[model samples]
Target: MKQKTIGLLGGCSNVATAEYYRFLNEAVNTRLGGWEIAETLIAGMNFGNIEAFVRTGDWDGLGRYMKTKIDGLVAGGADVILCVSNTLHKPLEDLMDRGGVPMIHIADPTGVAMSAAGLSKVAIFGTKPVMEMSYLKDQFQHRFEVQAIAPTEEEQCDIDQIIFDELVKNKLKDTSKARYLEIADRMRREEDAEGLILGCTEIFLLIDQDDRPDFPMFNTARLHCEAAVDFALS
Candidate 1:
C-alpha cells in the first residue's frame, strides 16, 4: 500500500500538537520496523487568533480561517487532514461535509474504542467549548451508540481554566491533576459512567493513564493520531 501524507492542522494548543506529532512518528516507525517514517505536513495555526474566534463564538470566522489554512495544506500535497484539537472538529466536520478535504474527527476513534469496550456511558472532560458543545456529544450517542456525561457547570469552568492556563502552556501540576481526578471520580460514580473521555486535546497533558486501572480513559489526541496513522498507511 502506498503511504499518504497526513496533514496536521494544529496549534489550537501547541502542547497538543506536539503530542500528536510524537504519537504519529512513534507509531509509524514502530509499524515500519526500520528507519521508515510517515509522510506528514504540519500547518500550525495561531492559538491566540483561534481562541479569539472561539471565545467570541464566531464559527464563520473560524471556518474561514480553517479553510484558508487547509487549502494551503492541500496545495502542499496533503492527502488527508487531521485537526489536532477536539474543539476544532466542529468546523472541520463541516468542511468535510462540504467536500472540502478528507479530515478525521478526533472523536471517531474514541467512540469506536468505547463501543468495543462495551462502554455505554462515559464522562467527558475538556475545555468549555468541547464539553458544552453538543456536536461531539451528540455524535457519540447517535453515531457510536455511546452516551456521554460532562462535568457540572462549575467543574466545566475549572477544566477550561486548567486547559488554557496550564496544559496549553505545558504546565502540569500535581494538584491540578488530583483535582481533575476528583472530578472524574465523582462523575464516574454519580453518572454511573463506564469510562472517561479526555475530550480536550490538551487534557492528557494533565491526567492520563488508566488511573482507575479498572476504568477506561479515552485520550482524544492519541486516538486521533493512531487513526491518522491507519489512514496514512492505508
Candidate 2:
C-alpha cells in the first residue's frame, strides 16, 4: 500500500499546530501499533502575518498566504489538507474551492462527535469572531438539529484574553483553568447545555474533562485530529 500523506496548514500559533501534529502521530501509532508513524507535510507560516490577516479579516491576504502554504504541501506530496486553526478556517473554504485539494472541514468531524455523543445542545467557546459569526453554528445546525450556544460578551472577552494572550503563547496558568471551568459550569447550568464544545483549538490548553466534571466536554483538537488520522489512514 502507498503511504498516505497528510498536509497541515499550521502556525496560526505554533502551539495548536504542535498539538495537531502530536495528536496525529500518536493516534496513528496507537491504532496501528509498533513504531509506524503517520506521514505529514507541514507548512508553518509566520505568526505575525497570520495574526495580521486574522485581525483585519483580510480574505484576499489570507487566501494568498494559505495558497502558498497549500502549494508547498501539494508539492511535498500531500493528499489531504487540514487547517489547524478554527479562526483561520474563515478563508479556508474559498481557498479549497479554488485549490482543487481535499481539505477536511473541522466542523464536520465535531458535528459527528457531538451527534454520536447524543448531545442536543452544545455550548461553543471560541474567539469573538467565531462566536459572533454564524459559520460554525450554521454548519452544525444544517447537518444536525443541534443548538449552538455562545458565551456572553463579557465571557467572550475573557476567552479572548486567555486564548490569544496566554494559551496560544504557550503560557498555561492555573487561574485560567479555574476561570474556564467556571464558565463551563455556568453554561451547563444556565444554558442547559448537554455538552461543551471547545470551539477554539487553543481552549484545550486551558480546560479539559478534568475541569468540566459536571458535563461532557468535546475537545475540538482531538476531534479534528481523529478525522485527520482517519483521512490519512484511509
Give each prediction's root-mean-square deviation over alpha carbons.
1.3, 1.3
lDDT string for model 2 (67-102, tens) is 998889888888888898878778788878877679
Which candidate ranks first by TM-score, i.e. highest? Answer: 1
Tens digits of per-residue lDDT, candidate 1, 1-234, equal 368999999888788888888999998999997777778899999999988999899999999998888888888999889998888888888776765568888889998999999989999988788899898999899989998888999999999998888889999999999999999889877879888999988887777775677778999888999999998998
Clashing pairs in 2: none
TM-score of each: 0.96, 0.95
Structural RMSD, model 2:
1.3
Alpha-carbon lDDT of model 1: 0.88
In model 1, what is the error at residue 233, expressed in angstroms? Answer: 0.9
Where in model 2 is the C-alpha error above 4 Å?
none
Question: Least accurate stretch of 10 residues (summed lDDT) in model 1?
Answer: 92-101
Indicate the worst ten consecutive residues by lDDT in candidate 2.
205-214
